[model samples]
Target chain A: MTMRSPLSRVRGLGSAHSGTEHFLTQRMTAIANVPLVLFFVYLLVTLAGRSHAAVSATLSNSTTAIFLLAAILSVVIHMRIGMQIIIEDYVHHDGLKMSLMMANTFFSIAIGLCAGFAILKLNFGL
Target chain B: MAEIRTRNPRPLSPHLQVYRLTMTMAMSILHRITGAALYFGTILFVWWLFAAATSRGFEALNSFFDTWFGQLMLFGYSWALIHHMLGGIRHLVWDTGRGLGPAEREFSAWATMVGSISLTVMVWILGLTLRG
Candidate 1:
């Protein structure tokens, strides 16, 4: 039992000063993924053995495009956060860990943008 | 800071060799492995998307994915996705301050393993039948 200011105790801030945000966000994405992934699996099953035009037409549907975009965004964010935690745990070197964390963020963003753009282009028949 | 040079080096506690493996421990490690697998496996998704959007390379990509090796990779990727998904659900249950008991934890671990395989098989079967 150490003495601490009431405000500080009430804040309950961790070293990063943002308590529980990362944990909650991760869970939020997981919850979102449940239905999204189910839909994705169903989509895949429907697309199997179909012609390129047929598959493209299915994905070009507005609803399909929207769901794909949301899933891609959620997945990329979730992946980045998950990888960041792993890197932080395993990488003891400060410099290398920082660099890896940055790379992870950029990689996730790149994947998200590329996938999202592809979906939008298909949806618009571009 | 200088003390680092003179510090004693010791084997860390809870080393894998010394500890008897348990279902929960194995599942925990598998969850991480599968998560990493999915991380790399996502490139396939991007490739498919790019191919679909361009409408030029899709036929070649599709044929490649139909090969024996491609089917094997797809099978592995599907299993990884489902397993990781069930593992995520288990984690979410734990986050709610529930399922921490020994029996519940073990059951969840087994359920994740079994459910993923079952789902993957069922999905593949459906895909195969519908293709006919």
Candidate 2:
């Protein structure tokens, strides 16, 4: 076997794709999370202890329904993105990391769909 | 195969014990732990939404959350939510490169603690007032 030079051994190891994308995505999610969280906080504060009928009526309202839907969807997406980095950085097995990331994404999408459907079904009086 | 060396000559960096712990350190750890907690807590929101959307009435979801254990979980979640939000604001300030100095970092950490507690108290008071 041909021996490789030390220079060739370390040629591709610079900051060339170094953790920058992950850092940027984390920041992006942080920004997205802010308003979504605020919306959720407001919703919880307003809805606390309301009767079932009143709560249902509020959820049926277009404005509240849409805001809740948007907030929940954003939260799911944000959580998925945040956890992906945590897993990628910590989980050593490449196959496990990929599988876990895929699971996280799918789970978020499923949750988002269910949340959105729930809000819309109530909105249409179904 | 070549025999493996018993030990490396190069020194390794010390772990967590090497540094003194402070409020900032506590806050930093809390931020990540709270993040993970919130990740799980978020599923509850999804469940709530789905229950509200699909069920004929709110009883299903309401009763589940109205239970003692559920209420406890909710309270913990509320605390975590407020704590993490304050931490996020602190992180944003740090992101802007404004609070990395020692004194300012300490102030930010304390602010996170105080703000989260204050918000939690305010929400609980509001909940009780409305309940009454």
Candidate 3:
């Protein structure tokens, strides 16, 4: 006889033991963001009020493009996971929670891709 | 949950509403709020990047950003970002198990608040000076 209830068995409630992934990823991205984001801030502040050509020239640099892409990717991942945790905490309706989580994931990916594409465009002058 | 046919209205656990705000609790909530704000702020950042890449919308975007309303929004976004970053640093410190004491936690919260404000102001000052 199984100790699990019928619903538990049906729902496949066994622990995958990978629960630490979310917590760890959040922290990893957080650590990465500290430096990347600071660099991002510095870039923006230095580039403030500059002409479009100047901004373009700065971004076209290989090293600058690389760091910008890394910042966007890391920041978006961190943003997505953080919003999911917020949704889980405050949203009580299961259906709404699932939908919001899906939207959260999609939104993060969309913005990240947009930012990445732009950076590449500048990098290649395309 | 599967076996219970009748649901009982049992006592619910006390939530945030029941607790008074302390520096620690306030900081935690502020961290979440700032983080949430940053999520939207990032959208604007993406748009800025897109404008820069295309090289078409930069002038219009710059004009808009020079407006008072835009400056206000930018200020708020910068503060939220700075505060959230400081909060993350505090969490990193606490993760090492060295800042769990009552005094340490509270002090860290206060430090994050002050440091974020100071940094944000300094950044804006630097930005304005550079522009000039």
Give the distance in Å from residue B19's predicted Cα in candidate 2 to where it truly belongs: 4.7
Roughly what TM-score does model 3 have, to 2 decimal places?
0.89
> Which residue segments of model 2 deviate by more than 4 Å?
A1-22, B1-13, B17-20, B56-60, B130-132
lDDT (0 to 1) per candidate? 0.85, 0.76, 0.86
Candidate 1: regions farther than 4 A off: A1-14, B1-6
**lDDT ranking, best first:** 3, 1, 2
- Name every residue pair that clashes in candidate 3: none
Question: Model 3, A88-115: lDDT tens per residue?
Answer: 7788777888899999999999999999
Looking at model 2 chain A, report the run of 10 residues with the lowest lDDT sum.
Answer: A10-19
Residue range B1-132, candidate 2, lDDT tens digits: 112245666565777688999899999889888888898886787666665666554576677668898778777788888898789878878888888999999998999988888887798778677757
> In order, what are the TM-scores of chain A for the candidates?
0.85, 0.75, 0.86
Candidate 3 CAPRI classification by DockQ? medium
Estimate, for each residue in A1-126, the C-alpha lDDT of model 1 and write its tens digit. 869876776553434555388888999999999898888887876775578989999999999999999999889988988998899778877789889999998889999999998998998766
Error of 3 at B122 (Å): 1.4
How does model 2 score on DockQ? 0.41
Question: Comparing to the true complex, what docking class would candidate 2 get?
Answer: acceptable
**What does candidate 2's lDDT look like per residue over A10-108, in tens digits?**
666554565687567667767776777776776676675567667777789888877777677667766787788678657866688889989888877
What's the TM-score of every candidate structure? 0.89, 0.82, 0.89
Measured by DockQ, the strongest candidate is 3
